[model samples]
Target: MLYREDKKGNRISALGFGCMRLPQDDREKCGRLIDSALKSGINYFDTAFMYSGNEELVGSLLGRYDRGSYFLASKIPPALCFTKKDFERIFRIQLKRLGTDYIDYYLIHCLSDYSAWNRLCRMGIEDWIREKIESGAIRNIGFSYHGGTADFKKLIDSFDWDFAQVQYNYMDEFNQAGREGVEYAHSKGIPLIVMEPLRGGSLTGKLPQKALERLAADNQSAASLGLRWVLDKKEILCVLSGMNTEEQLSENTAIAESAAAGCLGEDEKERIEFIKSAIRESFVIGCTGCGYCQPCPNGVAIPACFEARNNFENGKNHPVFKMNPARRQYLHSTAVLGKSPMNASLCVKCGRCEKKCPQGLKIMSLLEETAEVMEPAWFMIPIKAYRMINSGKKR
Candidate 1:
């Protein structure tokens, strides 16, 4: 595997394993996958407090390995953070969950606005972070962002951050944090970790006939092509891929082993552009499922709705996503992914989600579009029956 050198001379792997979506039913299998990942030289393991059982899962799986051999990373969600005591409580909880005494990397999860940063500042978060670093509890401190470019730069200039994580992809080259943020961070010598490099798997969706043939001539899959686009950049320190299976683990590891900065040639770059045009042309509603438009005031599941619709429209041919795609994902989203089952039909046209969206999506209308496409009576019947059966069974 390839490695990047930090200022401390630590060799961080270029391909980090994202633990948010580890297989739910088979802990043994997931543990084996984690073991295999470590055996394959992927030392960076990322999880978060909000990712349900992920921290515990990562801890249990990684605890068998020697602590000094790998790196552990976790995040503190901004919504639940308020005071120094709160930060202390959460960090200690994280350490316990991960079965570790110290975190190799720590981040303030999903910083969206300056107001949240100001709140942390008022609570003396900087000094608290420094204390943790001094005590050797946190080896590095940074943040993951979901705001526009201006606020992103403001936050970059606001603190003594060690690194930054953002949603970057071939499609999102001009979106949040976009190219400007990447260049700014690179100029400052901050290691920029990339998440959603596949745009939550949208970039790997079905392609146009022409685009498919073009990529196939080079023996490429949409997923690999999408990943290589991000890996092709020099500014990206690590590309986080949430692998649920052994095959994905092997494939991404191989890619990282051979990947280098600016590896895509003129034709390959043109093919990526062609693929981008193909995706945009087929898009009915543009949403990256980034969750910035979430916590809807009326309890509507905005990103989930768009995800189902987009997947229904494009993911039917993608092998990994082709299984009862839309309804199954929608059901899963409603049941487990979020706080409530606020389907697309629940929208009140409040327009709040649109303003918050970095993509400037027509959220209310798109929710209407989502309802028209994904909430048909034929699709709703079996899902409703399944939900009822499960609810009754649990009761």
Candidate 2:
């Protein structure tokens, strides 16, 4: 596999295995995938404290290998930190979970903007990081970002960070911490680790028909095309993919083996633009499902609502009579299987989510549209019945 050097001159694998989406039910398959990744020479593993049991899972799987052989990365959630002691407590908990004394790369998880980082600064994070680094408990310090480009630059300047992880891809080139942020961080000698290189599978399985046809003409699968686009840029230190299947792992590894800066020819560049245009035309909503606009006061599942609507709209090319799976998906995710109804219709137009969205979307109005399209009488009747039955059972 290809390699890139970080600020400390550590040779990290270009293709880092993202552990957030590891298959929870199938331990054996997960182990084999992790094993194959290690055997294939991928040395960087990324996880986080908030990824729910991921650190323990990664620890158990990778504990067999010599610690020095691979670079293990994980994040401490700043949202969970309110005081100096909280940082210490969380760090200790993460260490126990990972079964490792030192984390090779440690990050402030999902730091939104400069103000957020500044809050941590007031809580004595800088000194805490210094002590950890001096004691060899933390090797590299950084943050994973989910804010705009302007705030991103300020955050980089605010800290003595060794690296920064951001959501970047062909589709998100101009979105959250986009190309501009990538270049700005690179200029300051901060190595960039990219998450969501495929935009949470939107660029792969959700591609429009025209985009798929363009890829077919070039003999490229959507996953390979998306990954290569990100890896081709020399500024990127590593591109993280949350691989859950063998096919995804195999395809990604092969792409990483031959990928280099400026690997794409003119013909390939044009094809990517064509694909982008096709997606733009078909995409009904630009939500990245980042969950920044989460926990609505009125209990609206904001991201899930947008995702289902996008899925429904993207299926326009399918046969007219066929029931869109997105409809069922919406019902299942928002009401039927959930403890309470969290569908788009629950939106009260409070506009609280709009202030938090990194993409600057008109969330309140878009949610109205979602309710109109996704919450017909047929869907709502069953959801209402389920809620009544469940509530009565509780009583």
Candidate 3:
């Protein structure tokens, strides 16, 4: 498989086997996949404390092998940490879960904004991370981000990060932590790890018939085309895929070994651009986040509201949220964010935001609909319960 050298001069596989989607049902089945991946030259494995059973599955599957043979990456969930002691306790639990004494690459999970980063720092998380790195429990420190480019840059500059993972694909070049952020990280000597290369299988299986025809005309499988697109960027150190079946593992392994860097021919590039254009046309909301509609009089977090809607509609199966249960827990935990900025019911039919909107979105009507559908009683009850449970545990 192709490999890229990190800042430390260690060659990491261009394709990392993410354990969030390991084949389960039994330990033996899981081990075979892990064994096969390693035998086929996959040396990087990524899991998280929140991925249900994934840590144990990976630990059991690969623990018998020499630890030096592979690199392990996992995340520390910031939402679980209200204090420095919580960070220490969570790190210890993660190490035990992975059956490893040290993690090769450790990240602050899904950092969304500057506020979250400040919260972490206020809790002495930076000192805690430094201690872990100094103590040899963590080799490299970074964060996985799912926020705006401005916030991403703030976090990137806030700390000397070794590597950063972003949700990137052909369609999301302008979305959260897009291509600019990726390049920015690389420019700072931090390697980029790309997640959602396949857009949560939407680009592969859920493609419109016309898009499929365009790909077929080029004689490329949907998966290979999508993966090759991400690997086209020389700055991307690795692309992590949560493979679930043997066929997926085999296909991806083959692609990794043969795909050349920056090898997308003119036709391939044009086709991908066309596919991206088609995907954009399918979105109902035209929020490009120009911030024209900002300063909402009703205190509505319009951008954040749109993001949640977009995630629910377009990113339901995203690995960031789907593969890891912690994502769900974190989203639920937001209900207790010291009085949320604005709920769906707070829109109050104000037309002021509409006048400022570039896309002319009927702000009042949309908010009403969003509140009714997105904030249904069925969804809020569970989230409320989760916040209560988490709050009590902290107390």
Q: Whose TM-score is greatest here? A: 2
* TM-score, predicted candidate 1 vs. hidden true structure: 0.86
Q: Once superposed on the true structure, which residue ranges of model 2 sit more than 4 Å away at CA? A: 316-323, 336-339, 378-395
Superior by TM-score: candidate 1 or candidate 3:
1
lDDT of 1 by residue, 1-395 (tens): 99987546788898999888799579999988998899899999899999888899899889998999999989998779877799999999999999999999899998877778999989989999999999999998889988889888888889888898998999889988999999998888788889988887677654556667777787887777878888888988889999999988998898888888787778778889888888887777778776777789878878877777766776564477655566677767655223345788778897888867867788888888787777788766766667666664310
Please give the CA lDDT of all the candidate structures. Answer: 0.83, 0.89, 0.78
Q: Flag clash pairs in model 1.
A: none
Q: Worst 10-residue stretch by lDDT in candidate 2?
A: 386-395
Model 1 residue 270 CA deviation in Å: 0.9
What is the TM-score (0 to 1) of candidate 3?
Answer: 0.74
What number of clashing residue pairs does each candidate have, in the order they appear?
Answer: 0, 0, 0
lDDT of 3 by residue, 129-153 (tens): 8899999999989888877788898
Q: TM-score winner between 2 and 3, please give it.
A: 2
The root-mean-square deviation over C-alpha atoms between each candidate and the true structure, in angstroms, is 4.9, 2.5, 10.3
For each candidate, what TM-score against the reference? 0.86, 0.93, 0.74
| Candidate scoring better on lDDT of 2 and 3 | 2
